[model samples]
Target: MPTDLVTTAGQAAGRVADALAGLDLAGPVRDLAAALPGGRTATLAARPGWAELAALGGRARRHSDALDAAARAYLDAEAAARAAAGPA
Candidate 1:
């Protein structure tokens, strides 16, 4: 794949990861839970939701890192190839 495409994909993934990281779901949930009567209900509502959000963010970050690595590898390969060709 082209370096530009890979780099752009990486950037997009990074943005997604950033957006997910910025989420304040827990605070809202905690506030809402506090308004409610029971601790168990709050725990049930909060844990799985945040876990899934965290997992999604992790996946986006990993994807961004992989794309960045691929872009770097491609650039390195191109540079090496050009160096091997030498003065052409």
Candidate 2:
């Protein structure tokens, strides 16, 4: 439970969360669907695929959030322990 490791984990999780939040999981497929002549058919065909992708993205974001929370909790606990031990 080294503070440096905890901090690094938090930072890594934050980066992952940012990336996941910014992801455009369905944008490419949606664009392709719109560009096709039978746009409606393409859209229908891709509907399930995009939906699944979105769901996976949501799950990944949630996991990232959990990781961040865990890292924060560890840091907080370490701080509390140091404070309780007082004066080195």
Per-candidate TM equals 0.75, 0.54
Model 1 over residues 1-88: C-alpha lDDT tens digits?
5898999999999999998866666677767677775778776665646546667788999999999999999999999999999988
Q: Each candidate's lDDT (Cα)?
A: 0.83, 0.67
Runs of candidate 1 with Cα error greater than 4 angstroms are 38-47
Error of 1 at 56 (Å): 2.0
Candidate with best TM-score: 1
Off by over 4 Å in 2: 2-50
Residue pairs clashing, model 2: none
Best by lDDT: 1
Instruction: Please give, for residues 6-73, the per-residue lDDT of candidate 2 as tens digits.
Output: 55665665666666655665787777777785757675747755645545555666665676677788
What TM-score does prediction 1 earn?
A: 0.75
The count of backbone overlaps in candidate 2 is 0
